[model samples]
Target: MYVAVKGGEKAIDAAHAWLAEERRGPEDVAELSVDQIKGQLKLAVNRVMAEGSLYDPDLAALAIKQARGDLIEAIFLIRAYRTTLPRFGGSEPVDTEAMACDRRVSATFKDAPGGQVLGPTFDYTHRLLDFKLAADGEVPSAPERAEAPETKPHIMSFLDREDLIQPEPEGAETPPDLTREPLELPAARPLRLQSLTRGDEGFILGMAYSTQRGYARNHAFVAELRIGACAVEMGIPELGFAIELGEVELTECETVNQFQGSKTEPPQFTRGYGLVFGMCERKAISMALVDRALRWKELGEDNVGAPAQDEEFVLYHADNIQATGFLEHIKLPHYVDFQSELELIRKLRREAMGQVRQEAAE
Candidate 1:
């Protein structure tokens, strides 16, 4: 039956037209350029890129524009586009040691190699509104200075020499790609990290916060947090050598954690690692904390029934796309189900009234 309920096509078309007008705002106002969003609102672009698992700044900017500056929507656009791309070949892992770092800091040591460079951070900035920016929006260029040489050794190398930290086994085993396969519980570290890097920033932040609130608390110290660009390389089987593809901005974090030794082993400091697509230090740090918390079983610690410690729970709910799809589905038509429920409720009420009247007559 052709019912009036199916007449939403015209309404949807009109709604889309209205949305387009609202997105552009008034014609009198200056139209926002994608370059402006990419350059000025760089952090938002970085977040979309990081979560989308793509590295193209231009495309990310375009996605942002199309999404009306909604970060999640932009991420969704990028991710959806990414699925249509043909997989050529995987690149060799980039070396962070050779990274040209812009921002590098460590909390574990007072003085470290490469001398803690604090480049372009809002850590100490006052949160007060800048009236001048609102009025003119003009920003002066920073004073020119000679670029320092990049020679920072990892903080963990010092502890490694002293045999104070747990040593990871060196191997060339290829890790599982979460994107290609169905997620199964008791996930490996690589799968867990994959989920976390592409996870919703707010969700990962909350999970990390839970650890700080004593949910499987692992005393974590930021051993090193670095933001910079590293050259990506890909091996050519024909040439029998690896060639540089390009450089990509990355935020890498290494967290030193307290590990209580089991009956078979000695106590030593553990480690948690986080590496993201772009300059997202907050997400990187949060991923590290959550990563360490989920390492309970491998580290020989009790489960403690913490949310972050549950691999199944963390991996399943970490994806924003999946979460949003399920959540938004509630708005879809449920007329048949609601009607059935209404009829059942009325019938129950009538039956209760009849029972009461019979008891009164008795």
Candidate 2:
């Protein structure tokens, strides 16, 4: 049975009122709208959606506003709101191969089949701050572009024809849901991928960086990175076919690692994969590296006892919501435990003082 901490009604009400007042900020300034957040603060909305495991941009933006721009707290609000949502039938795997390319590039190929198309990126921009934005935030119109090719073939397919990269046969008709299932050790690739895609970005990025810093022997080559809109199809049993639900923006990364051949297999390059909602290239790349690091056993490699290689550790600590609850609980009322500790410490001190006085008197 859960114990409700009863009391402090007035104080709680006062705190809430003050919090609302603070959230509103100065009366002179205009309030931010959800549409503005969804349109301008696209990355922030993407991060909340990715971590919250909800793809709705408008809801994510509303959560951000409600949380006063605290992303983790925004994610918490989104998660709480998610519980009320009804489950629609799951969609078939989205066809990334036929994605309408917004930004597609490959490090493995200098002049690949579909040449690099640099769409809105910060990669080449000088880091200097534009002080003009302090007063006015106006920008000129972007250059128009002709529509890209109807189909941009995956770069990895070229290597696959030559048998250079390891093959990944599709298994598991339906992937398991981490939200529904209790996380068990020795998780399969599908489950691991599920957790990684929704996992905390900072944690995943740090873990991936650790591998790059010699914590693990997993170094990745960017075989291909693509960002685009793909149609989502949901199976309609009544209609006897799947129908397109809508389009969702996705970022996918495929990385090739060093070749390692076991006794049964010949020397071939291994691969890592990352796919997430929106143009989250950094998180996608991080997830791919970490994914590769965790696949040591399956790839017939010995474990070096790295944190990233430990599925149990990574999976348990990856969810920021779970981590925050565990951590934040300590700050709540722990009066009973704190009082017990205080009494014990005082008793020990009294005994020591008494012994010292007795010894001196004798």
Candidate 3:
């Protein structure tokens, strides 16, 4: 019942040629440059870098160009490329306290140490289309500010000192790497956070929104959301000291959520943390909310069967590449299976018709 399709190789080559031509579009239009994409389509590059778990902007921009403006495909390309690279050593955990922040804001406090610098945000921008931009698009430069402070204490430290928030215990045990190892059920906080950080932005956003709509609602207040550059350090075994490994732009979000008190414990605020590779505030915030919601088991909260609270559901379905590959695989040849199904249906129909004919004769 299975028939083999011929000329697949020639068909594929012809299709690829057509695709190359399509990617370039009309010959009159200027082809997109990687640098132009990197500078102008920054948010696309940022999303790719953040989700791909790689911070090379140039490469991300190249992937964007090759993927034809599909950010998820760009992320997939980056991720695939990342797997082939050699691993040196792991960098030290970044010190966000000493981050040279470009943008720092606190919704919990009226006055923060950095004084709420709203640097380069589209939050207040109107949605109106500017026709002038189509003719000659040039963004005006922003007014310069004084040099940022070298160090600023975290807003959570104040609550930490008062024991008002659940204490995060530091452990010497190395956390499990989800990228290296297969994911297991009842994931630890580190694994959960890793999964959430690399998860699809829209899927995580939808899950976070579900939490807000009373599916395991955790009243979350954005304690601090900071976007800035932080120095990464790596210990050199030969040098016997840690050395700086350049800086990376990060968007760190800390959400303070409602608490529950048990017989032995007093009511204290809980924390949801999110740290991403680029200046992606919305993704970071959504990751934080979903992170908090998924901590239901450890926090001694009831399982309200929320999508955000389901670790197996969230972690498995959150990888866009995996989801896309499986979804798109349907377009591939299914003739054999379809033929088998058709044969089965026909046989069943034949049997049913034969029975009807016999009954009529009787």
Candidate 4:
């Protein structure tokens, strides 16, 4: 007996209301303020901004709270919101060389022109859980240094003196926007870097780890990792002058890789590069490795069929929002399709049985 299904709309509405209530928790409890979330959950905000292609901390925090800490969902929310925002003029590329750096370090060099500033990193911290943080504990402040100059010099300049690393070329051409346009193959450096920055962090990390595990390993050393804010300027076409739009925190990674010099070409170390929004060093580093791996073809290296080398695979599955959405959508009702398949199987079984009986009788 078949029963007609009803109340789907009402049921959905009720479920939504309950979900909202659960997200908020008890009415007596204090609601999560955007500032609190932004400050306390900075890492989550950073991930959302990186993936969502938006840098608003408050908006990312709100999305996180609304999504109940489902980071991918929060990223999706931010992406949807970001799409509706009207496009302003594109900014002149922020000169990383001129960045007001808060943190700068080089693994390749013991000491460089611009002294290494460790800044804020979890690198030195012990992994043991801090029981003090269980309570609302405040961290002791370290002695503060006097405010220094606004701009800090890059360490790469030392290597640049020897002509070891590739010099960044100045170009008048504008880079393609991956969001507005479809991602085409054979992308430029800027386009490829853009996609990698907003890619799934875990996937990028895994691919990077795979390289260390002997998949197209190039023996990479961190040339430099810098985190700082850079001014974004936009040119007013009518005025013919660029104005400061804003500033954004960026993590830039440059890796020195083993150079493969041909008989004709002179031996020199090559570089892998990554640049990403916010303070995402790990993502940036991983991106740089993958970027270098993908360039094997262009660099005249043999195709090793590495995961990182496969542009189609990396670019296609990098976005967690797209991947998770399509994957989780399978949970949605597919009863009609399932019923059709079931009916086909049953019909085939009956036909086969009939043919077998006829053959036996004969």
Candidate 5:
């Protein structure tokens, strides 16, 4: 068995070399630099970073290059590389309320505070593709800043002031880290949020869409969606003070759901929240809806047997790395496993045939 496994070592090495060569593509074409991927293919980098649970755009870009533009594979590389990194102290909770707004919009209010800043959005644009991009080498003019960047307050506060929305009390000061600890059943909101944020975009989006299609629909409305940069700060235990680490682009979505009233308390609008890495507006919005759907039990709402409402189902399968590993393992050598199954099937067939003959004779 050992020799048989070792015999394929040369073939595996050769296959890897061939894959590397193929990843480079035609020699005539200029190679895609990691910087190019980081700058130009920023959205792809963001997806990789988000799903991989890593924040380094440069590393994500290099992974994309090495993976030959396969985003999932790039994310896989990023996730694998992340395990080798040393653990540093956690950063302080980001202040999304004071984010330097790049793109901010509110579906519930037209004339929201700080005004509707539609920064680099395709909301109004036609779906038709621009041939100019296909022609290539044409540099579009740089986008001009309408005014200086400034911090803006979240729109959820507006509803909160009137006592129309449910109040969000603080959770544990030190929340559980999903990466370090095994996921426990009936996960808290923080753990669920972590899984959703680091979850696959397509999977999250699909689950959110299911809710809209009447699978535990929460009647979620986008109270506000903001994409901007927020400063990260962490406390140094030695210094007994905090220092700014750096700024990270984030997209936050807060949704005001249907009114929740009971016999004891007056009706107030419930809310769902999503905060994701970079300008992933769609993912953020989807996350908020799913978050709301999953909160059915906590919100005094009936469990409608929806897939999104199943916490165990969502968290367990949301991880692409785990899903891919289990799924991809089928392709590997399973000779012994298959042979046993094959023999069992043959014996079952023979027994069935014998029984048929016996019955006929009777």
Candidate 6:
């Protein structure tokens, strides 16, 4: 006997309660503070901020805790909170050239204007887990260096001196916001770069890897990568000037890609760029490569129909929040739709059986 079950509301309430309990495990034990999460789980917080398009570490940490350690859920939470926030005004384009960088390096050059500083990185470290960190051990700090100039230089400027790199055009026009509007086909460079900045780390990495594996193999050299904090300024109409709103950490990567000299154009190198929130160098670098690959059409390069070269494919699927939402949404109730499909299949089977019997009698 088939019986209809109806407890959707109660089930939802119970699930929510369980989730809350899981998020704040063992009530007797001390709860995790936002500061502790921000400091201890820094990489996860960085990923959330980068994907969420917000710079607040504390908020990101809180979201992480609330989401029960799901990074994408944390990003979704931050994104939802971001929408309710009242935007006072737009900020002036940050001057990366004037950025006081903590770490800056270039793969294209051995030495540049701002000397290479390989700050804290996991590149050289062995993959083995550190046992000392299990007890929350303290390590000795490195010796401090002399204070550098307030306005540090960019490595790309050195290449521009000899006209080696293409000069970026200066524009005073404001760019469009992707979050406010539905993404359209044939997006501009600004929009594409914006989407890539907050894109899923693994998705971007896979796309970048595809290009390297001959999907659209454009030889790429890391022109420069910089990680540091920069002041954000907002224009105040009352004051008639921009004021420093706050400071945020950023990771920026610029890649010099191979360019085949066309009949009309000279053999000059092109570029791919990535800029993301916080100190996420690997993600930024991967994003830059994919960005360049997607720009093949504008650069007059032949499109090999690579996944990386497809603008619609890359931009639409890059966002982790959107991807995860759609993926997980399949778990939601679809009983009505499933029932309709089942009825149709049963009707088709009955018709087939009747036809077979009639044919056998004939």
Top model by lDDT, which number? 2
Q: List the residue pairs that clash in candidate 5.
A: none
Model 2 Cα displacement at 243 (Å)? 0.6
RMSD of each: 2.1, 2.0, 1.8, 2.9, 1.8, 2.7
Model 4 TM-score is 0.92
lDDT of 6 by residue, 201-315 (tens): 9999999999988999988899899888888887889998889888888889999887876554556777888888888888999998998899777677888888999999999
lDDT of 1: 0.89
- The best-first sequence of candidates by lDDT reads 2, 5, 1, 3, 6, 4
lDDT comparison, 4 vs 5, better candidate: 5
The candidate with the higher TM-score, 4 or 5, is 5
Q: How well is each residue in 149-191 modelled by candidate 3, as lDDT tens digits?
A: 4456799998999999988868545678888899998888898
Model 4 spans with C-alpha error above 4 angstroms: 1-7, 168-172, 263-265, 355-362
lDDT of 3 at 29: 97
Query: Each model's C-alpha lDDT?
Result: 0.89, 0.90, 0.89, 0.85, 0.90, 0.86
TM-score of each: 0.95, 0.95, 0.95, 0.92, 0.96, 0.94
Task: Tell me model 5's lDDT, rounded to 2 decimals.
Answer: 0.90
Clashes of 4: 0
Q: Model 4, residue 276: displacement in angstroms?
A: 1.3
Please list the residue runs of candidate 3 whose C-alpha ends up more than 4 Å from where it truly belongs after superposition.
1-6, 147-150, 263-265
Residue 316 alpha-carbon offset, candidate 5, angstroms: 1.0
